[model samples]
Target: MTTTELINQIRKKKSFLCIGLDVDLNKIPQHLLKEEDPIFAFNKAIIDATHHLCVAYKPNTAFYEAYGLKGWKALEKTIKYLNEKYPEIFTIADAKRGDIGNTSTMYAQAFFEDLAFDSVTVAPYMGKDSVEPFLAFKNKHTILLALTSNAGAFDFQTKTVEGKELYKQVLDTSKTWENAENLMYVVGATKAEYLAEIRNIIPDSFLLVPGVGAQGGNLQDVCKYGMSENVGLLINSSRGIIYASSGEDFAAAAASKAEALQKEMAVELG
Candidate 1:
């Protein structure tokens, strides 16, 4: 989806919430394990329950990858269901993929061409050549990792190089690449204080922020500093919403959690 389309969805739904489908067989309702494709079954229920409450859905690729070919097929089915049923809803492949130029091109084709995700999370440590191939795809977004939510982020992201924080340099350098207009960023909500500074560097770029909800990152604080005029935020909540229950009513429970976040997001957008 284009930036304008995304912003419009935020306005229409009064939400910037992106529900993360980080599904694990061990965490889902035990009954689902009997299904032919437990992962897709769980995802379908979650999507059905919460689709109206949020503007986006992100399925982290690793979850499916760990399960091998069967898992990949489940993910494919889940994504296809979302696209066909709710085409307006933004979809992200939280793949965090980055590699050499040729391999990155294949990865880009896999997600953007074959699977048809609206965006994919990419690691930028390999520099412009590795990420630019993903950017080459029309209308598809490359969400480059900037400041992450993990504790390990402090070990490098915040480290100064020539007196500028490393993440700031990433933000600055990424803008210089071709098709940079298709770029969004992964900025952790836990680092909310740095958002104002990050905004100054790229005032209009959208940020796909995780680390809210279960991560204890305050929603209001993220919106206060991270929000742009277009409501440039896709705040993600994975475990807190999707795993709200381990019972047969799991989908309904997930809906309730997503609804709570969406309600708060509506107020923030206003």
Candidate 2:
């Protein structure tokens, strides 16, 4: 989806929430284990329950990859379901892919062309060449990793090179590449204080921020510094919402959690 379309959805729904469909078989309701595709079954229920409460849904690729071909088929079905049923809702392949230029192009085609995700998370450690390939697609977004929520982010992202943090440099350098306007950055909500500074670098670019809820990133702090005139934030809450229950009523419980966040977001947008 285009940036304007995304912003419109936020306005219409009174939310910019991105529900992370990080489905782990071990964590889902035990009854689903009997289903032919437990992963997709769980995802369908969650999506059906919370679709109206959020504008985006991100399925982290790792969860499906770990399960091999069957897992991949489940993911494919999940994306197809979203595309056919709720085409207006933005879909993100949280695949965090980056490689050599040629490989990166194939990766781009896999997610953008084959799977038809609206966006994909990409790691920037390989420089502009590795990432620009993903940015080449029209209307499809390449969400570059900036300051992440993990403890290991301090190892390089926060480290200063020539007196500037590495992530700031990534943001600055990425804008110089071709078709860079389609780029967004992943700024973890755990580092909410840096949002103001990050905004100064790319004032209008959307941010796919995770690390809220189960990760303990404060939603209020994230909005205080990250929100722009267009509500340029996609705050993600995975475990907190999807795993709200381990019983048969899990989907309803997930809806309740999503509603709570959407209600707060409505007030924040107001």
Candidate 3:
């Protein structure tokens, strides 16, 4: 989806929430295990229950890839279901896939073409060639990793490079790429304080922020610093929403969690 379309959905839904479909079989309610494709069944229920409360759904590839071919089939089914049933909701393949040019092209095809995801997370370590192939696709987005919430992010992202933090350099350098306008970035909500600085570098680019909810990143702080006129943020909540309850009432429970967040977002938007 284009940035305009995404922002429209956020406004219409009164939310910029991105529900992370990071399904872990072990963690899902045991009742779903009885289904033909437990993973897809769980996802379908969650999506149906909560799609209206959020603007985007992100299925991290590792959750599916770990199950091998069966898992991949589940991923395909989930995306197909979303495309057919809720096409207006933005879809993200949180694959974090990046490689040499040729390899990256295949990765892009897998998510953007074959599976039909609107966007995918990409690592920038391989530089332009690795990310351009993903950006080359029309109407598809490449969300590059910037300042992540993980403790290990300090290992490199915050380090000074020519007197600028490496994350800032990533944001600065990426804007020069061909089709750079298609780029969105990943900024962890835990590092909400840095968003003011991040906005200074790219005031208009959308950011796919994770580390909210289960990761304990504060929503109020994220909005205070990260939001632009367009609500250029997709704050993600994975375990906190999807796993809100492990019993038969899971989907309803998930909806409740999502509704609470959406309500808060509505206040922020107001």
**Tens digits of per-residue lDDT for model 2 on 194-221?**
9999999989889999999877899899
lDDT of 1 at 190: 95
List where candidate 3 sits over 4 angstroms from the true fold: none
For every model shown, what is its TM-score relative to the native structure?
0.99, 0.99, 0.99
- Cα lDDT tens digits, model 1, 1-270, are 888888889899999999999989889999999998999999999999999999999999999999999989999999999999999999999999999999999999999989999999999999999999999998899999999999999999999978799999999999999999999999999989999999999999999999997887999999999999888899999999999999999999999999999999989977
Residue-wise lDDT of candidate 3 within 81-156, one digit each (tens)?
9999999999999998899999999999999999999999999988989999999998999999999999999999
lDDT of 3 at 43: 97
Clashes of each: 0, 0, 0
Worst 10 residues of 1 by lDDT: 1-10
Please list the Cα RMSD from the true structure of every candidate, rounded to 1 decimal place: 0.7, 0.6, 0.7
TM-score (C-alpha) between model 1 and the true structure = 0.99
Clashing pairs in 2: none
Candidate 2: where is the Cα deviation over 4 Å? none
